[model samples]
Target: MTDEPRRRGAARTDELLRVTLETAAEVGYAGLNVEAVARRAGVGKHTIYRRWPTMAALLLDALSRVWTTDLDYHDTGDIRADLREQFLRSAPALAAPPIGPVYRAVIAEAQADEALRATLHDRFLRTVEESTLARIKRAQEAGELVSGVDLTFPAEVLCGTLYYRHLLSTRAVDETAVDALLDMFMAAYGT
Candidate 1:
């Protein structure tokens, strides 16, 4: 294919992914299907299947496009403040339309699907954790981080708490919650 056709193809794929996430958010992963996504994207089911080859693959693509996996870590030399800011930045993304519900659905699906679990771990979770660990190391080098804490520690504690609030409860993951979460972690690690 020529460059123009290839560019249009990529654009169509992007649209398909956007529609996939939105449909999954609205109807849930359980309810999401190729038919729905194709219909919403205004494309044929063959188009989606041709791109993904499997439902899991399609979901992984959609998530990769929309999931906010990284923090806006500016390294202001205060790990605590930076982490707080990161979580504050994450709050809106968590509560944002499509992302929140889609994440909740995927999380629920991953609990039951081994393929999803492996894919999420391999692709999203590991990538985000490694990036975060690298950021943590930078903070450590600056003598602003707690010694001996692991990288997954923040993911297990802070992100865990935030996700709990996001999916399980009606309580909002607001600024107060973000501050409280940051405080809890800072106290734990003495950061």
Candidate 2:
């Protein structure tokens, strides 16, 4: 009997998250607000506030649900090939609708909001960077990459370059660009 309330709460949370994404897609982050999301979700504002203290937090959670899979790298015994596969797989999400715009919006807002910036790094960027670093470390252990090297910069560059292109430049992060990045990484780090 007690489980019923918890299940309902979980279901309501999922519904709210879905509505939040839809609202962000419809209006962009600048137009998103707690009251608006609550109204759109057919719930009161307190419902959202109870789950997330701020709209940024809610948006982060919504984005996290959809963006998790691409952050993970496959261990195919070849670091270059595995990274290439993961980067290619993730490129579309950064360039396409739904996730891309909301992500860009959050990043832009974070530039002015220190709290949001910290939360963004803590919640999202750290996960991506950690995953990339872990993959590289594994490759190093297996002798696919150079030994005794500080891989942190390489990992950051690998992820940061794509984000820079996606968020700042007019250029596309197509296959050629990804290959070029991988080629550089291999030239620098590969054994």
Candidate 3:
């Protein structure tokens, strides 16, 4: 009997997350609200409020569910190739709908909201940066990169440049751009 309620709750949570993504895709972050989600989800406002304290929190959870790409690099022995592969795989998703637009919206809102900014960093940016740093560190240990250097800045630059181009510039994060970025990184850090 208890299992039935738990299963239903899980299903409802999934439905809510789906509706949240759909709503965000249609109306964007500025147009999104708890009431809107509740209406679209066919649930009372209290239901959503019980799960998430705020719209940003709900959006964050929704984004997390959809953006489930491993973000971890494959140890293909070649650092440049590994980085390139990861970037090429992820760049398209970042440039497309659902994940892309929703993420951009959160980022825009984060600019004005300190708490959201911190939450966004804690939930998303930090994960990407850490994964990137771990990959770079592995390469350095293998002597593919320069020795005894702090890779944190380079990792941020790599990830941040792509994000900046995607969110702030006109450039597409295409294969050519990825190759160019890899070339630059290799030249600067390669042993």
Candidate 4:
């Protein structure tokens, strides 16, 4: 509750997230357990268990926290440009070193764990969909984009393709690819 305790809590949470990322990347999804993360993070087993109720929950948090990409933005008045900017900035984070492996492992784990998959969809993918849909609707109302454009398509294409490439492609997801993907999506629906 106090400042010092809060600070320590925040720092410890950060450490736990980092250790999970490293451990997940190194040992992979099935191999990742809280005890190892606790030992690596130099925290007690209770620290992780207290914060996250389950192993799937902890890994989901680690993936969400450690492999972060804050795609938030103030509307720039041009919907296409805003979307492009978001992709350009956040796409690179996907291809970055430790985050990529952490992401891959979380996704892999999610495949086997129904609960983890649902949590990830709720936490990450749903938020993205809602945000993009809202922005696209705003753009439509503002006359920045054409009406009746189903916002879902663009959001799905942008995020889905990025993940598709990240998980499958031998080539890295880069700035140019992000720009191209945005362009392709925009061209389909933009006024």
- Best of the two (1, 4) by lDDT: 4
Q: Which ten residues in a row have the lowest lDDT in candidate 2?
A: 1-10
- Candidate number achieving the greatest lDDT relative to the actual structure: 3
Model 1 stretches with alpha carbons more than 4 Å out: 1-7, 68-72, 148-151
Cα lDDT of candidate 3 equals 0.92
Candidate 1 versus the native: TM-score? 0.82
On residues 70-118, what C-alpha lDDT tens digit does candidate 1 reach at each position? Answer: 6547688787777777767777776776677787788788899998889
- Supply the TM-score for candidate 4: 0.84
After superposing candidate 2 on the true structure, give the runs of residues whose Cα lies further than 4 Å from its correct spot: 1-7, 68-70
Cα RMSDs, all models: 3.8, 3.5, 3.1, 4.0
Global Cα lDDT for candidate 2: 0.90
All candidates' lDDT scores? 0.76, 0.90, 0.92, 0.77
Cα TM-score per model: 0.82, 0.92, 0.94, 0.84
What shift in Å separates residue 24 of candidate 2 from its native position after superposition? 1.3
Judging by TM-score against the true structure, name the best candidate. 3
Q: How do the residues 18-93 of candidate 4 rate in per-residue lDDT, one tens digit apiece? A: 7787788789878989889888876689988889998778777776775457767559898877877776677667
For residue 85, give model 4's deviation from the true position in Å. 1.1
Q: Rank the candidates by lDDT, best first.
A: 3, 2, 4, 1
What residue pairs clash in candidate 4, if any at all? Answer: none
Which stretches of candidate 3 lie above 4 Å from their native place?
1-7
Q: Positional deviation of 29 in candidate 1, in angstroms? A: 1.0
